[model samples]
Target chain A: MSATPTPSPAHAPDAAPHADGTSALLHAEGLHKTYGSTPALAGADFSIRAGEVVAVMGPSGSGKSTLLHCLAGIVPPDSGRVLYRGRDLSALSDAQRSALRRGDFGFVFQFGQLVPELTCLENAALPVRLAGAGRKQAEAQARQWLERLEVDDIRHHRPGQVSGGQGQRVAVARALAARPSVVFADEPTGALDSLNGERVMQLLTEAARDSGAAVVLVTHEARVAAYSDREIVVRDGKARDMSAMAGVA
Target chain B: MSISHTLLGLLETGPRHGYDLKRAFDERFGHDRPLHYGQVYSTMSRLLKNGLVEVDGIEAGGGPERKRYAITDAGITDVEEWLATPEKPEPYLQSTLYTKLVLALLTDRDASSLLDTQRSEHLRLMRELTRRKTHGDLADQLICDHALFHLEADLRWLETAAARLDKLAKEVRR
Candidate 1:
């Protein structure tokens, strides 16, 4: 609504440190990953601040998912470093990285990935439960998140019983239930129709902002990426920050 | 948009002075560009001359004389026809972006970067529209959605162009 554009809090890709000198919540530099004989990421660089939604966009197999995997410590890069809150992810033990993921990071995939056997409420509470909270406390927190995401009415149903849109909302509620500092969402709205997709994006973004959690969203759809504060385009295994590019041009 | 037809439609509800018509037009339709008083009066005069509207009353105000106008039966028929007609879809066979891309290749410039810059510009507008839609009412949301979809189409073209830049460069040089 303001005449001036909203200034992005995300750090520029090429900058060694941010202009303001504040460290990013998660940062990766010169990352390279290979699967068999193919290179997924050659030399990608990325950074995100707390509460900033940065969409990772590219054509299929262009390494957007690889960049996200490296950032989240799910897949180690062959040649570069990833820092989470100034702590090197590679330096941590495998157990430590897993622990960090459980306690400090959240994830939402295109398929929702809800447990087919668990009730929606139980599925939403799984992350918090795994993070060492008591079942009652975890379920209570998850219930609140489910309500906020507008899927609480279907809390007693299993994943198979709910609609795709409702299931996706439950997955989002699960991701936020642990109060993670960052949420890694890869095509969270990819499976839904435009109306359902937009609604999911609206709720996901609004809930993430309210929780003050940064989102590294991997999406090829421009409409979905539009929900992000800024975007990084991964081409040929490299990342380019569109906002930073705009600033330079 | 046809300002005269729009003004006539507004008058269909009831007779309104020129100033009141402008305000109503602005509130409902004019968002980015509001109707100027001169444009409103000129449009009203044209509609009156065309038998689409008639002067219902004249009121002498403190500053100037105000004329209240009402829509005629002809105006209602005109609005119906306009509403029923489907707008022609633009083919965009010749695109400015295509021209710029070809020129960049011809001039030995960084065509890929040009596409990147344009893509950024397009996303910037999309982001603005997205934010507006987040806080806007349903009407605002629909309007922004239309603009957002168009910009998204442009961005998709940019992506495809970037992917085929090498092939395009080969053809342009030959």
Candidate 2:
């Protein structure tokens, strides 16, 4: 799972609208974080609207992953605000944040990360099962997603029994089965071949669109970023909007 | 442009009449604009002459007798070679955009505005393709991705050209 909400101090206020009168389903403002001497994020601002797919791209060690962690509340920022629907994420108790992530957020990573022993169907249903859905209800939802992703025939197979591409599809089915409000994908297709990579990206973005869930995709590949509605590039520990400079030098 | 060779490849699957060939080709690769009947027949005739294809059968029809075509062994070799060969990457050594920028500078025109206009055009197309990708199927999304990549390169070129405009203008006038 990409989401593991970190505990933070409570009683934080709701995040106000951005100075430019902009609002979004998710927002981050002046986020600053450092790890010892090396800084990860240096006053980065980001936002995403409903049903929009945003890509976070950068060179290695440029803090793209950290930005994602901050936005998802997997880690708390040194000094900033992460707001989910105007509610300050920092304001929520640890349990509340964890529950919120479980209920409304989904994640997929570069590695398929399917438990080797669990059948594909069982893996897909894990998120729902964790959320306290009945075993039958969870498996039913998982089966529907698997069929939609065209991997229903392999439902009974263990993760190792499936090919790398098929495993990623299972991961996607799992991430989307819960119908989360947002999906955070970190190089979700990095390990697959080109054909399979394209297929996975297509399914991920299309599924997000169909579910009306916003996506925050972190990837270094321009081809992958091309699928996004907007892109933010992290450079030297700062994140900036690269949508306008997409074709620039 | 490679329609003739593509038809030979298709024929390798099995013998097919011109109508069948056209439909198969359209379904696979010509979703945008299908081959015309005349083009298909003409291509078949040329392939027949070249010995890459042969008449497998003929059926009488209302307008004209339909000759089903089959690929020869030679046709299979040709297709294999074509498939193995890498396509020539279009480096665009002397691109039209480069020519336009130089011409603007040579004629003492506002090269900066030219670059700006081109940049905006590229951005416009990128935005349009982005919208299309959002709503398109897998095939449509792939097609848009291809176009978007080329346009992205053009956009990068436009920016570099804009940055060097002053230096280019000086060199051109000198």
Candidate 3:
């Protein structure tokens, strides 16, 4: 977690290379992200192992979100590459990229994006159904995830009915329902109080380790970053070596 | 370093049963600046409130009251940061201990008592460093050599001061 990734280490890293140049699960070299004329990321270089939790942090507009989006194939990077399990995401076709996004990555933003009108269980299971899973079985899997996350009691409640912490926990269970290899979460605990924030952070770190899914959590709070195994700080759209104190794991 | 800073460093080593931490601190650091029991427990409580360290469990009875403390990620972040930032060790030279020793010459207490303490400390440190240099390999080569030089300088200073005291003949006493 302390070492740098290899140069041009194959696409879709299954494990991150150490400082000595070993293999990693994901690697991005010379990664650059821009929006029209403004640069959101500048030739950023970062990587994560298959089951390692790496937190990315920075000041507002430092390009954390853009980097996450670029890595997940939700947005294309201006330059550089996003390699997942040996394939360059930028080189994949749109449908192939979509399939990867739907099947290989799980995302959770500050907003859980749960359908407000739907029951918590339905909201969590809907993604499974959309992924072509049978409804009953999908919900059963969803229920299991809910129970695992300690949100099973809220299965029939709406997002509005649960506490912020409980809602986010549900969101996490939903994201993990399909067992994606990676989970990109932005400010997962930003909306909660310190008590609840700590609870959520612990849950996230536990989830990543238990599921063997690498995590790229983004945040500005040092307390949140303390939960991560390692962290990379972004500044002026470039990934920089953060001294210590910065994201959520 | 201050007692509080040392306490924080001890807590940074992963969760330790409070009593065990106290013993480790005493064994490793307290010889120089002993951490009072009250101070150690107080610091533990403060660290817990600050979310840097946590109490994992409590022993059922008096078997040292398993007050295990662990360094949270935030705590690691803190120490990582401390290692990164430059430390100003020169200030320690002018700390209260040295200043008090220097001022002791103006009082009725025999300077021999203070000299005895300093001489004992210097010899002990020199012996420890010599043993380490001969057998234990330091992880950082340059830093270890630098530390050895610093200790050597302290020993030399102590020897010179002891000679100066012997030559004074009570002239500067009154």
Candidate 4:
């Protein structure tokens, strides 16, 4: 509340990004965002510890998406650095950032975001394939992740052929097939009903933590964040409160 | 990593039979990360039961065959969580030393000597850290980064602890 920051994570687990005590796997230091003078993140400082799952919640217009985008380096922060493994996003060239994003990060958006034309396994393996993995090897790893995510039953089904929740699970499995350093999601279950939403949440939470990747999800829902090892409430475009929950045993 | 953590850490190294984990852990940690043989078997049983570790299969033809422990996706998840769990720094336990504090009244040995001895050990540790870079298995940047932090923590704890003990010893002399 007094605005004194915690340590800059110079002595943390180095493996975790968030504040879950895995030691700042994803750290956004002094982040500020502006959309043509409409402020989004107001000098926000946030991090996702390694193996942590964080849910960001706020009212509409509260800049949840802005924070996610900024942290993910999808939207440039007007100020502040997004640090992954101690390297700042602002310092990387666009191409460099893209390659790191492709190799080291995974994303699940509000929509399923599945490429409709590809079958579930094909879509799930896209990132791996993009990384130049052979089609056979990529699909094989994708099948493993899909099974781990409990979506293996639909591996051959296209996005349009599956239920919305099922499609989103596929999206998550796809995002994680590369075992990225961090996984980012924007309103991951905003499209599904309660049961589906909860299922997706648990699956994402379990899958990400098991893989030791930091998962940051933006939502207005408290329950969604509860599944994470840490939760930070962003309000008025600034990180207002932060707390950590025990990691699931 | 604790005992279960030790087992999980071994799994991260790659698949191994149950006994292989025990031997590798002993080799990796030396006497410091000691384990009870029963504890290793217990951990293996639980991991298999919980679906975190799977028997990748058996290697036969050598007596009673052996089951290899590979981390299932769930096992890795468990290890990640274990790695990420909040660590309440363990209390600096040197029971014999704490005893020295309580029984220093009865000792005739010089107090400064103890301080000097401990400080040297700490300095040696810090010096070795400077000379050390993880060269082998823990070569990944992420894992190495974490190890560095832990080492730094050890160094800090040593310095602060040694300083505190020095002060305590000086006060006791007064």
Q: Which candidate has the top score in DockQ? A: 1
User: Once superposed on the true structure, which residue ranges of model 2 sit more than 4 Å away at CA?
Assistant: A1-23, A243-249, B1-89, B92-174
* Ranking, lDDT, top scorer first: 1, 2, 4, 3
Residue B140 CA displacement from its true place in model 1, Å: 0.9
* Whole-model lDDT, model 4: 0.70
Query: How are the candidates ranked when ordered by DockQ, highest leading?
Result: 1, 2, 3, 4
| Clash totals in order | 0, 0, 15, 13
Winning candidate number (lDDT): 1
- In candidate 2 chain B, what residue range of length 10 has the lowest lDDT sum? B115-124
The digit string of per-residue lDDT tens for model 3 on B23-134 reads: 8877765544566667777877887888877777776774434577778888777767776888776744554434554567656566645644553444344434433433
Could you tell me how far off, in angstroms, the CA of residue B59 lies in candidate 2 after the best superposition? 24
Off by over 4 Å in 1: A1-22, A247-249, B62-65
Cα RMSD of all models vs. native, in order, equals: 5.0, 8.2, 20.3, 19.1
For residues B21-111, write the lDDT of model 4, one tens digit per residue: 8887777664345666777888888878899888787777552127777888888888899878998976757655556644553364654
Q: Give the per-residue lDDT of model 2 (tens digit) for B26-138.
A: 98778568899888988888888999999988887633238888999988998999999999887789788899999999988878667655654565567667668768888
Give candidate 3's TM-score.
0.56
The per-model lDDT (C-alpha) reads 0.86, 0.80, 0.69, 0.70
Question: Candidate 4: misplaced stretches above 4 Å?
Answer: A1-22, A244-249, B1-174
Q: What is the lDDT of residue A144 in candidate 4?
A: 80
Error (Å) of candidate 1 at residue A202 is: 1.1
- Report the TM-score of chain B alone for all candidates: 0.93, 0.86, 0.52, 0.53
Cα lDDT tens digits, model 3, A1-249, are 112111112213255455437465667778887788998998677667877777786668889888888888888887788777667888899999887767677778787578899988998887678778998988987887787777888899999999988899888877777667888889988888866776676676676666677888898664465456666767678885332222211
> Candidate 4 lDDT, tens digit per residue, A1-249?
112111113222355333333356777788888998799889777666677777675567878889888887888988888887777888899999998889888899988488888999999999989988999999988888788777889998998999988998999888888778678888888899966886787778776766667788887654455455545656568774344212212
Q: Report the C-alpha lDDT of model 2 over A223-247, residue by residue, as the tens digit.
A: 6666777777676688876545535
Model number with the top TM-score: 1
DockQ measured for candidate 1: 0.53
